[model samples]
Structure formats: C-alpha cells, structure tokens
Target: MERFAALYEALDATTSTLEKVRAMEAYFRSAPPEDAAWGLYFLTGRKLRRLVGGGALRTWAAALTGLPAWLVEESHTSVGDVAETVALLLDTAGIGGTAEATTSLTTWARDRLPRLGQLDETERQALMVSWWRELPTRQVFLLNKLVTGSLRVGVSATLVARALAGVAGLPVAVVTHRLMGDWTPSETLLPTLIAPGETAAEVARPYPFYLASPIDGDPAQGVIGALDAFVAEWKWDGIRAQIVRRRGETFVWSRGEELMTDRFPELLVAATALPDGTVLDGEILAWQGDRPMPFAVLQTRIGRKKVSARELTAAPISFLAYDLLERDGVDWRERPLHERQAELARLVEAVPSPRIARSEPAVAGLRVDEHGVDRVRVELPLPPVAALAADAVGRLAPLE
Candidate 1:
C-alpha cells in the first residue's frame, strides 16, 4: 500500500510523459510482482465497481470522527469531492493516530475490498474505521476512490503499455496486444503478459486500431491533385469493432478494448463464416434492410450481458468490414490500404450473410476549371459532411 501510494503520487504530480513512464518502470522494477500486477491493473484504468455509496461512506466517516453529520455534508460540498473531503476531515481532526499500513495492494484488493461487499452495514463500517486509523491520509483518499470506483488519474492505457514494454524489453505493439481483452491481475498472468514469446491462446486479442484524421473544408479546394488516388467510403455512424476468428474461436472487440462476445449474438453467428486466423476491422451497425438505423437503436444493445431473441430480431446488426488486419495468422497491417481492402472484399464476398458486407463507396464528384486544373470532391450522405482532400485522398493507394 505504501509503495503504491508513493507511485500514485509520483504519477499524479507529473504532466510529463517521460517522467510518468519512468515512475511506472521504476515501480514495476522494485515492487513485488503481486502488488505490481494490481498496480498495473488499477493504474491502467481497470476499476472495480463501486463497493460503497457516498451517503453510507460519509455517515461512517462522520461517525469515526465524532463529527456532526451536517458538518461532514458541508465539508463535502466545500471540497466538491466526497473522497477528498473525508480524507481532509480525517487528517485535520486527527481522528486516526499516526499508525502505519502494512497491507500490500494485492492483499487490500483481493482480501479486504471483496469482503466489504459481503459484510453487514455495522461490520463494514467497523472494518472501514479500522482501516482509516491504520492508513495515512493519502492512502485513505486512494481507498475512498477505490471504494467508490472513481479512480481516474489522467493516464492513458497507451502510456502504461509503453512503460511496460520498456520494462520488459518488448515491442510496444506486443504489450498493447497483450493488454487487450478480458484479463485479471494474477501472478502467472502478469509474467506471461510481459513474457517475450507469443502463446497460442493469445490469438483472440485485437491489434491497436488505426484512426484517421478528420478533413475539413471543400474537398476540391483542399486537395492539390487529382482525386483518383483515394477511395471514398461512407463512414458509418456505428460502433467500430474488430472481429477475430482464431483457433476455431471468434472474438468481437469494441474500439474501447472491451470483449463484447455475448452482447451481439447475431454477429458471432455470422462470424462463423469467416476463416480461422482472420482479423477484420469493421463497423457494427444496427441495420434494417440495406441501410443502417440510427445510433440510438444500437445503444439499446450496448453493455447487455445477454441479448434475447426478440431484442436481437428488433436490432438486427451487421458488420461492414473495411480492412483486413490479418489473414491465415499473418499480419497485414503493413500492407497498403488497397491490398487490405481487396482481401477484405474477398472475405466478405465469401460470407453468405446479407448482414455482413463491404462498405459502400461514395461517388466522387469531379470538375475541371478554365485553368485546366482537375478538382475532385466527394460528399457523404451523413451529417457533419466529410470531404476528402484530393492530395490526401490520392495518397491512399486505391483498391483495384
């Protein structure tokens, strides 16, 4: 707990990326592997669900300090964060003596936090008070944040992966891939995650997505050259997903790195048609006939543990595959976009489902001025009109 608290303070105090990475690397090197595993889990944005509510926590804190409930409420309002307020009140009131904490991050998470959920209110309160008396103010703040499940400390998962990669002497891409999907912090898993060799079971993890920069202004005026170089497709308003079929198993991952295998059952059924060791980058849309339904319709299915037959029928989903990242266990990311698209087209054509298809191309608008300069413009059907600059569009090798 003390080591984690110091590391957290170091990370929280700095805005420099290099400093943050160094801090993380140093902590990973010195801390126990078990505690380091939990540290990585929490610092990399995996949070436990809220174990205690604000009202209950505040009441308990007030009881511990022998302070009036209204005074605690007023302090909370002034602090604007219940966790910080409690930490401050406890610190100033000196309710808990200067005792030190001997618990490690793993012990606190695996043994203490889980038990809080099972205990009756009185037992839970007593346990929390005892913890407060033993732990320092900084740790109390962190514990409160953990109990409330609101521990956002302004660090990106990418940075965390980069630090781990540096520590393990592995590629950032490898670390990033290993971090994806459902993973728990375990002694064995942590070592495997940082290990150099690739394992057969890790095939379901998705690669980091390639995102495009938004283009602004008139497509014709913005682009300096002819429009033939770029291929234009409708950017569908839907969830961007990567579908992986490896070792006779299919996994669906959202761009946010969530493994959403069960929510969209129909997509999983359709994915069976894909060949093993294939990874497709696509958009998951709520479809009605040939066109996509509004995004609101798709929101109903998000985060659902189970999709009923009626709900599946109502919000029938389809995957518009746009890029092929892998084929037959081979990485295709370094290949040009056109080549990737060609393979994706072939794969989609082989699938028998109407729900799955290639993204439709938009008609390119072209014009020649009296000065004899060729100008090209493409307009999308959706709002926040997207136009591709001719020079930028031409840079992408058009799929044959």
Candidate 2:
C-alpha cells in the first residue's frame, strides 16, 4: 500500500508525459507482479464498482474526526473533493499508526477491501475507521477515492500502454490489445502479458477500441487527398461495443471494458446466428420500425439488471455491426477495409435475425468497387460519421 501510494503521488505530481511514463515503468519493473497487476487495473481507467456510499463515508469521517457533520460538509464543499477533505482531516488529527505500513497493495485490494461488502453497517464503519486511523494519509486518500469512484491520476490509458510496452519490449498495440476485455488481475497475468510469444488470449477477450481524434477544421478540406479516398458511415448514437461468439458462447463488451452480455438479451438471441469463433464490433442501439430511436431511450434500459417485458417493448435493441474482427477462428483485423467489409456483408446477410444488421456507408455520393476507395470525387453534407482504416487495428475514427 505504501509503495503504490508513493507511485500514485509521483504520477499525480507530474505534468510531463515522459516523467509519468518513466515513473510507471520504474514501478512496474520493481513491484511484485500481483501488486503491479492491481496498479495497472486502476491506472488504466478501470474501476471497481462503488463499495460504499458517499453519504456513509461523510458521516463516518465526521464522527471519526470529532467534528460536526455540518462542518465536515462545509469542508467537503470548500475542498471540492471528498477524498482530499477526509485525508486532510485525518492528517491534521495525526492518527497514523505503524501497524499497516507494510500492507501490500494486493492485500488491501484483494483481501481487505472486498470484505466490506459483506459487513453490516456497524462492522463496516468500525473496519473503515480502523483502516483510516492506521494507514498513511496518502493511502487513506486513495482508499476514499476508491470508495467514491473518483480515482483519477490525470493520465490517459494510451500513456499507460506506452509505459507497459517499454517494460515488455513489445509494441504499444500488443500491450493495449492484451489489456482488453474482462480479465482478473492475478499473480501470473503479468507474466502472460509480457511474454514474447503470442499467449492464447481469453476466449471472451475483446480487442482494444480505437478512438477518434478531434479535427481542428473541416474534415474534407484537411484530409489531404481526393474526396473519394475516404469512406463514411453514420456515427450511430448508441453504446459502442463488441460481440464475441466463440466456443459456442456469446459475450458482449462495452468500449469501457465492461462485460454486458446479460444487459441486452435480444442481442444474445440474435448472436446465435453468428458462426463460432466470430467477433463483431458495432453499436447497440434502441430501434423502432426502421431507424434508431434517440439515445435517451436506450439509457432507460441500460441500468436494468433484468429487462422487463414492458421495457423491451418500449425500446427494442439492435446490434448494427460495422466491422468484422474475427471469422471462423481467424483474426481479420489486419486485412484492408474492403476485404473486411465484404466479409462482414456476407456474414450479416446469412444471419436471420432482424436485430442483427449491417451499418452501410452513406447512400449519397458514395461508391464501392474492387478497392475500398472509389476514384470518383464528390462532396456531400456530412452527418456524424466514422472512418474505418486499415491500421494496427480496424480503427473507427468518428468525426464529430
């Protein structure tokens, strides 16, 4: 816990990208694999669901600091952050103890933290207060951040990937890809991640999602090529996700690396039509007769653990597949845009589910030929659009 707290402080104190990367590289190289795995989990923007409520923490902190609830509330508002406020109050109390100085990050994350969920209110409060009194102020701050789901180190996942790539002596792409999907952090997972050979990926793993960079001016003017050199499709206002059907099972993952297979049961039914060992990257949208409903309609269903029949009827879900990443147990991400799209079209046609459909290119001034790019140059009004390219992965650059 102390080492990770120091690393967190170093990362938070830096504005230089190189300095942040160097700090992370140093930590990864020295920390035990178990600790490193958990550190990477949080640093890469993955979060554990909130274990305790903010109200509970505030009440407990006020009681522990022997301050009135109103005063703690005012402190929280002035500090503009609950975690920092709690840490500051505890530090001023000077209650830090030596007993927890050697607690491992793995011990706190894997062993101690999870026990809070099963504890009653009184037990939970006692346990939390004990921990706050014993831990250093920095660790307490991180603990509070974890409890409130507000732990951010002012770094992007791309930078973390770069640092890990340097440690592993592999491309950044490989490191990012390996980090994708739902995988538990364990002692051995780090070794597999840095291995030189292609270790078998989890059967339900997803490829890292490629994100769009903002363009400063008009996209067509700044593209530096003929207009037809690009392909455009509607930037579907829905959950960006990947559906993996392998080993006679289907898994749906959101771009945030959440396993959401059970959220939309209709997609699971529709995915049955897909062949084994196939993966599709696309959007999950709420649909009406022929077109998508507003994104607000989809939000109503996203929070439900079990979709009610009324909700299903209110907003039907559809998976509009945009790219094919795998087919028949083979990876197709390296193929050109045309080849992958051609195969995706054929596969979607064979599927019999109306909920499963292809996201075709724009109908106006668009042409498809032997090559993905058509020679005919034309200008047309652009809606929200996504550009697919043959790169490290089939990067879907959404133009806003």
Specify the highest-lDDT model's number.
2
lDDT of each residue in 1-400, candidate 1, tens digit only: 8888788888889999999999989988888888889998998788888888888889998887899999999999998998889989999888654536768899989988999999998988888888888888889988998898988766788899988999999998789888887778887766788887896548889987755454444434644345565556566789989999998899999998888989877778888999998998878999998678889999989968798888888888988886788899887876766677777889999999876788855544444566654433444555221233322311233221
Report lDDT per candidate.
0.79, 0.82
What's the distance in Å from true for residue 348, model 1? 1.8
| Candidate 1 local distance difference test against the native | 0.79
Candidate 1 C-alpha error for residue 39, in Å: 1.3
Q: Candidate 1: which pairs clash?
A: none
Off by over 4 Å in 1: 67-74, 97-100, 210-230, 262-266, 294-314, 365-400
Question: What C-alpha RMSD separates each model from the true structure?
Answer: 4.6, 5.5
User: Which ten contiguous residues of candidate 2 have the minimum total lDDT?
Assistant: 374-383
Candidate 2 CA-lDDT value: 0.82
Model 1 quality (TM-score): 0.83
Clashing pairs in 2: none
Off by over 4 Å in 2: 49-78, 98-100, 117-126, 211-213, 218-225, 245-250, 260-277, 286-318, 327-335, 350-355, 365-393
| Candidate 2: residue 69 Cα off by (Å) | 6.8
